[model samples]
Target: MYDFNFHKPATLDAALETFESSDDGQFMAGGQTMIPVMKQRLAMPSDVIDLGAIDDLNGISAGNGLVSIGAMTPHAAVAASGTVQDAIPALAELAGRIGDPHVRNRGTIGGSIANSDPAADYPAAVLGLKAIVRTNRREVAADDFFTDLFETALDEGELIIAVDFPIADAAAYEKFENPASRFALVGVMVCRTGSDVRVAVTGAGPCAFRVTEMEQALAANFNPEALKGISIGADDLNSDIHASAEYRAHLVGVMAGRAVGRMA
Candidate 1:
């Protein structure tokens, strides 16, 4: 790894100050993506501000009809939370299926969403649930937060404080995962609450995005039958050695159907 100064601030304000005071700095939540990149000499920030010491950035709570998850809370914690299971079992299930056990223990939800990896699981849930991303300076709706592949709306020195997800009436997630890495080849989150229906898809494209047609169909029928002839074109999907864009496009519909089929 490149030589760099490290700071573990006890509070968010201190961390922000320390990071901004440096010529170049990056926030470290769980260090899942940043650490690996640094080790490869792909990133050489002047300072690394660790958010782990900030007491307020880790926990889970429910209030005002939403589940608030602290930015620094690890995936394992989310997967095991009874509150998450009771309020949104689909969210917890998605957390449990991210990567492997070791990755889950070290990866944080804030870090994942902030990095905005297209194949990452959190974005699908965030967009599907229409969650609000609470940052240091502002609140960004999930629809506007993820701008593109490996990118987000978070500004320079901006840090995610927490994410608030509304509890849907019924929801489910299904992923077609790469066996070795467990990253989604194509994942779908289907949710229905009152008159609102949402279908968020990931892994097939450059970023996680909602399928409005699928949402409308599901809103009308709210079942696998609703998606009988629906399919997204492969023209804009990611084609990697793991799977062709055509295959990924096909999996999107399959996964969405499965997710809706699994809803209780």
Candidate 2:
């Protein structure tokens, strides 16, 4: 890694101030992706602001028909939280299954969302649950939060405080993961919130996005059979060495079916 100033601020204000003052400063959350990129010299920032010391950025709380998860909260905490499990077992399960034990222990929800990896698991849950991302400046809806591959609505010096997930009537996530990395090749999260059905897909496109057509079909008939005739074109999907765009599209449909099946 290149020579850079490292600051571990005890407060959010201090962190933000340090970040704002530095040129090309980066926040270090879990260090899962950021550290690797730094090592490869893919990203070289003048300073690194660590959020680990901030006490407010950790924990899971659920009440008032919603679950609020701290931004810096580890995936393991979300996976193991009794409150999260009780209120949204599917989400808890998804967290448990992300990456592996090591990654889950080190990765933070905020980092995952902020990085906005197309194949990351959290985006599916965030979009499906219609969560609200609370930042140091303002709250951004999940729908408006993710912009594109490795992009988010978070402005410079804006730190995510937490994510608020509204409790849904029923929800489930199914993913086709790459064996070695456990990253989703194509993941689908299905949520039935009251009269509305939401289907969010990740790993198959440039970013996590809601499938309006699938949601409309599910709204009319909340059954796996309802999606049988629906076809997801491969043009908009991602194609990589592991799988073709068409294969990813196929996995999207299969995962969607499994997700809906789990809701039964």
Per-candidate total of colliding backbone pairs: 0, 0
Candidate 1 global Cα RMSD = 0.8
Model 1: per-residue Cα lDDT over 159-248, one tens digit each:
999999999898899999999989999999988889899999889888899999999998888888989898799999999899999999
Where does the lowest 10-residue lDDT sum fall in candidate 1?
Answer: 255-264
- Model 2 residue runs over 4 Å out of place are none
Report lDDT (Cα) of residue 144, candidate 1.
96
Runs of candidate 1 exceeding 4 Å displacement: none
C-alpha TM-scores of all predictions: 0.98, 0.98
Q: Report the lDDT tens digits of candidate 2 across residue range 151-220.
A: 9999987899999999998999999999999999999999998779999999999999988999999999
Task: Highest lDDT: give the candidate number.
Answer: 2
